[model samples]
Target: MNKTFKIYAVIFIIIMVILALFEVNKKEVTDWRKNFDVNQKSPFGLFVFNKEAKDLFKNNLTKIDVAPYDYYTDKNKKPHNILILESEIDPESWNKILDEVSKGSDAMIIANRLPKNISDTIGFYGSKISYENENVLKLTDKKYQNDFIKLDKFPSGRGFSYIKPNVQILGKTVEENNEDQANFIKAPFGKGKIYVHCEPLFLTNYYLLQSGNVKYAQSVFSYLSDRETLWFVESNTKESSSLLRFILSNPALKYAWWVFLGGLVLFIFFNVKRKQRIVPIIEPLKNTSADFVKSIGNLYLQEGDFHDMMAKKAQYFLNKVRLDLLIDTQNLDEEFAKRLQLKTGKSAEMVNEAIVLIKKAQDPYASVMKEDLARINSLLDEILK
Candidate 1:
């Protein structure tokens, strides 16, 4: 009975330890998960929420699904309504859409700046004014005050001043300090409307938490609720279209001669170096002086020119001594005596006599006595000392 009780106690302890380890592993798995309330009505899931916004989209709104830009460009899917949100829109992009709209393409563009080319394409029409500011207006009935929050006052460099003359102004602009200025506008183009907002923060999650932004957001969406709107929220990264890439690649075709020349130069440099061969090594022979002497000796022996050879050898030795010993060659006898006397502490008269013997032996073909050569060699030894 005691053994049974011990076995049961051990089983219970193991079960408790296993449960503790499982709990620890479970916590580790989901450590990075965050707990926050998500707003279903906002495009950005975790932004401002208001009772009016939730109710406005309760029955009428449907989330639009569309392919990527490249896919859509290839597919040529016709959208009845379009909404674009970007930090800034250049004249080129704005003009392209405007031209499409003018050709009866029903689309609405929402961007920070409505370039002049686009505004001109779409004749401006006045719309509902916002009492918040006389210049601010509502192109659509969509309003969400809770989502629009004012950020700290920072200069918004310069705002777009040129819009299409015929483009209608929908939002009213509130007069503020020149630095803190902000405005919004809308214009009709064919069957669609273009809404331009000055501040991009009005749509971001960070600014949408403001008290009145939610109402503004609701109003914007409500106005476009009637159409099959295609909301195109621009990605942080700009996408290059195939047409733009082709244009850049074939710059000569586009009359960009400079670009074509630049590409050609770069191509030449890369290809030219690749086609070249490796340089070969030509090793220099060692013992240069020995090789030179051997060649001279062979020439002298073969030509039987002992007299000229001895004369050249004597001249070579003399030149080497004068230059290496730093003695004047014009008055070599006197200069050698003085230098030898100073360098080797030898008598000047002995050094002078040695130089005289070497100078007199200029004609190597003459019967020169061996004793004279021996005497000169002895003197050379003493001078070297």
Candidate 2:
């Protein structure tokens, strides 16, 4: 019973630990996946994602993807339902659109500039104006005025107002050059309607959070709700397109492989050609015996025991000389006398005296009277010299 209980308890603890780890991993995955959703729609609202704006009118309207103004000429293909949104709209885009509309193709243009040639197609046009001051023209026509509601503030931060007219003002500009105000206007192009708004913020997620902006956005969609509207919101810049292409080209794999190869070559070159540190060869001291005798002598001199230190040094030097002269110390009396006579060419008596002094100095019991270091040094100099 005890064994079973312990096993169950251990299993339970393991399961809890595993669950905690899993929860941490799950949170990381969720955070990593939280990116900008371009297709996310507002709940109970008409604002769709910016990327999906073109498809908003697909059911009721046809979409015409107009290239830049420079690319469009009279000979270019024109669609029945045309919308123009360019970074800079030139006379060529206007001419092509106007020509298509004149040919009975429904068209709308969202641009900051109005072509001098296509003035009749524009219901309202202005270079720049303040939208906040009540200086705006109020349409007395009930039909037109009923469709629009004046906004107190424009998304552009200028004091200008927004013309929230019906869907006909889809791409039209109700305000201009006012930094604070946004404009929405609509006009008829043949049997189709053209709506234009000066501000692009209405479609963005940031501006959609504004109080009345969502309503305005929905109203814009409501205008085309009757027709198959093709909303075209372009956010692609040239730099962004190039970056996207580079990222999708699998550059990491190509560059990373080359980097690895280069690193391997560098590693091989350093490992093979680089010199290794040599172990230092320490030679033993050559004159250690001499150094030891000199150190001991200096110590005795400093202590004012010059006679004792000099006698010790003399003894060590004599022993080394005896070894070099091949003198037999076993028969010290006779052999030492003979070898001393041969090596020094001295009489036996003199050599015996010197030998006696050396032996007595080495003896611990021999009474060699202390003297000043200078006197002892002079005696050693005379004997050695």
Candidate 3:
């Protein structure tokens, strides 16, 4: 890979490593949203409640993931107490739940608010009470009225603002001003009862982790009849809408996600570096024939060997004529000059002069000079052209 790309890849890795370390070491912010997922350990989740469900139900709790309508539609399934948390029941599910409750199956719904249909059908409008300071939660029964628990934080919710006479108030939020707002209620349907509580926060991990809040949850369950409890564990919450949220909701999965991303980046870096290496440039070999010939010419000129140089030049010309023009140069006669002039398209005079110079240079007794060499070279060049 090129130097610029390697530098960018290294910077990306360093940034990812820094992010991983920061995420691993930073103090985790508490999520206060009332998601109430059974497996989540967030403050508003139900992990603690789910873990303590067996104790609350006397080892009779069974988790169901389907809608209440589907769960009750099964003929083979026996009637059980239905427990719903942090959900708004649809009309179909509510009708099915009502049918089950009328047929002797109790259902307890705990949420911050209830749907309009359910609220109208149950004869209560779910409400909230915002207190600027912390409050106490307790059962409204004479036996547990004084057994109130102090909330570490101000409660963000209350209960029904209005209820029909048929719905009996079971619990209330005692504010600092002694204003008791009903947060829990029960209504009977046929042979079974339907318990509705507005403040679902009381049963979340945050509240349940408190020293005495488990007792409050037990008290809430006490309002339901003793039976096999089917806890509806829903996976359609906002937190479960995307895989990213699911991964981030769990510490182990979140860590693994970051690690997988880092590994993927590293794999790309090494793989590209291995496959996209720098390619070296190769230069073509140079032609040195001209330089070698020039050096030999200089040496002959320095040695004053004009006769030998002229003879060799004339022989080279004859060989070139035999190879290129298919002409025999064994004799420098007038017939040879005419044939050479016709073949080379040169003047008869230049061809004849070149032939005469070649014969004189080739003669052993004739003396050759630099002037004769220059004249033969000029005549030969003209004839060849």
Query: Highest lDDT, which number?
Result: 3
Cα-lDDT of candidate 2:
0.48
> Candidate 1 has what TM-score?
0.37
Model 3, position 296, has a per-residue lDDT of 98
| TM-score top scorer | 3
Cα lDDT tens digits, model 3, 238-335, are: 34468898799677678868777876787687668768667899998877998999999999989999999999989889998999888888877888
What would the TM-scores of all predictions be? 0.37, 0.35, 0.62
Q: Could you arrange the candidates by TM-score from highest to lowest? A: 3, 1, 2
Per residue, candidate 1 scores C-alpha lDDT tens digits across 158-248 of 2345456655444433335332232455566665566566544445454366556566666555545354544433443234566766666
lDDT of 1 at 272: 71
Give the per-residue Cα lDDT of candidate 3 at 242.
86
| Model 3 regions more than 4 Å off | 1-6, 74-79, 126-128, 236-385
Error of 3 at 91 (Å): 1.9
